[model samples]
Target: MYQKITVQTKTEVKPQTTAHLAQTMTLLNMGNGEVEEEIQKNLAENPALELDEINRCAMCGSEIAFGVLCKNCMNNQLKQDSQYLTFVSTREFPVSEEAADNEDYFEDGTVDRQTLPEYVLRQVGMELDDREKMVAASILTQLDDDGFVDVDILELASYHHIPISSVERVKGLIQHADPVGVGSKDAREALLVQVDELKRSKDIPEWTEKVISDHFHALLKKQFSEIAQQCEITINQVEKIANFITENLNPYPARSNWGDVRNPQENEMLQLGAPDIILSFFENNPQKPIMIEVFQPANSNLTLNASYHAALKTVDKETKMKMREDLEKASLFIKCLQQRTNTILRMAQVLVEIQEKYIREGDRYLKPITRAEIAKKLSVHESTISRAVSSKTIQLPNRKVYPLSVFFDRSLQIRTEIKEIVEKEKEPLNDQEIVTKLEKKGMHIARRTVAKYRDMEGILPAYQRKEKVKTK
Candidate 1:
């Protein structure tokens, strides 16, 4: 008989190229100013890297200054009347000293229109009736930053004139919304909800829920040996379950609620600076083709130092090795920078193509799109698209600066609809009446959501509006 031997093998996964990773780290996620700062930092550190005296436009190869397109190519682009033209420029609007000093005013969560309560309400509101919605709203609005319910259920029930069971039911519904555990009473409750959600779709370890529910304190303290003793499982099994929980679940659900995208507060601040991209109509007419400009920090070309290369041959082996390393680093940086520009140009073209009407018109015309959809069109990872758009502002043809993320805000169209509906209301309509109107217009949303959107627009409720109208 042939001898049977059991062999173990290690599987090696190939990693991304250094150049690709460098590109991603250096330029893919950086804003215009941040990219400029990175390039300047590299230039200062690397003797082998130098800025080209004769800067050229990447498109037409015409000589230009640092960070911008040649004037001739720009004129030709406009004269051609292309549907949309993407060019690189460094021109920026000057921000006031007061604005610079008060950057915190923009970055702080105060101006964020998409509050967590509003976001959670959008998710859970549709399943609730008026009373349940009020309860849900009360619970959601009172949540701490971690998305845990901060208020007492008994007090809330008393205030709303509802049974404690009704409040409990509403809280249960809220807990099951996206992010899975949001609105839970505490971290333990949040983790339990997440485990329940995981169990629905996939087979988790049999002891996962038990450990989370019964031995949660031990788990939190990482007393794996004690948990193993109590649960009668091996320490290794308990460790694996711990690893699974760490990988899959979050105790603070609100922190990761939006996925890879920036939270609403960050989105609000992103629009404060000079726009990274500008869309303008040809010859100042909306009927004409749109000119799209993607801004770069520098107009000059980043190039390798020829003198540094020449001196490398004359140096000792030690110095020559260092010089060669510098040359490689410089070349990689240049390539990555170019890749960044190309990626943004391609993305800008796609955006203009899909959202041309919205660019020419207003928020009412915004076509709903997701980063994933754009990434699919561009044959890139969704996170790549997210990084490209993050912290970048875009100026529309109407001279208003908004975050590039505004292109993907799915709620904009509905919010616009609500504004229009409210604007044209014959009498001040209640949220349910507004919902019926929206249903007729092929838009469906919950009444509470209608209330939230109306609140976002600073519109008064039906009774308040009626009272104001009577006063008028």
Candidate 2:
């Protein structure tokens, strides 16, 4: 049997403008800074458009600079709502033992932790030969926050082009230096050395010594019964030995009393310079719209004088047209910059609204969201959404802020509710337990899938979580 059929349907394909196509192409190909630069160039070329400056407070006409805030108005506003305060949480390092000294080394009589490395070298002095000192100095350089040399002896030896035995000898010498535990390889070694030093001054029992050196695993596993059986002692004796080990252990065995400190590396900051525009979610309220400011040149208001315009009119027509084109290009640059800011702010507002829950809470409450969802909602391609989010930070009501890209993650099979179920389990819940719980809630996920989520969350297996009640 042979059959022929023809079907026709009318469809309208909307044509894209040159400007729209250019904007889309730029968004797809360029980074945030490049896109911003392109916008600035366009604004510089477009003469008709001018960037408005906010020299005074919009609410109360008072001159202000440095920030958008007018001093008196801001102070009054803060005083009016004293209860609504902002708090910023920050991380700080604990003071080291060396800093406790009252000796006046500098103007404040306190040596900065940053100067500790040089201080240690100066204290050590030129007592030993240069070679031995170099070896010792090399070991000191490798010391971690706890003052112990965290790297392997062989690795250090190879790096320094010295024999492993010589490296070990140098490390030993350094370990016996000012900080008793300095230059020791790892936690276990550091603890053992510190224990041995203490033992030299006071008599430590054989059981305690055995627990530190031979039965460290037992102490870590908290296997009191096994430790008791091995040591031919009761559970109480094993507990005492465990306590002794804990008391003797130097948790940060590498940290020396010297003032050496290091600063954390800074994360990259994104900057966009253009005139200011505010994007507001509320249609009726314009006063409290989201303020978007484009930074412009200080002398942006200065225009070509009347004399210069008259001089330009006297010039040849071809030269005058070229001059006009140049001015137009600069003005166009400015317009593009404004448009870029507007687009970014609009996209950011949409994202903030969509991820309100995550903004309020944090990672725990983060929903499984994607770029495509946002793109569809915004009536733009997925690539547009990606460009809008890249290198952009959104400030939330709670003073909580995060990168827009943080919201766009791969969908998770384990939702917040399921995660809470796993977390709230009385015992250490394995993948099987998680799977069972999910099934009970009408979510049929495999044990392997549960395991995958657990792994993603950085949770270890059940065997590792098992803790013994006694130490040998």
Which portions of model 1 show Cα errors greater than 4 Å? 1-16, 65-69, 75-81, 92-271, 470-472
* Residues 44-73, model 1: lDDT tens digits: 999998887765666666666654455876
Model 2 scores a C-alpha lDDT of 0.48
Query: How high is the CA lDDT of each candidate model?
Result: 0.73, 0.48
Q: TM-scores across all candidates?
A: 0.62, 0.41
Off by over 4 Å in 2: 1-20, 23-66, 69-312, 362-365, 398-400, 410-422, 439-449, 467-472
Candidate 1 similarity to native, TM-score = 0.62
Highest TM-score model number:
1
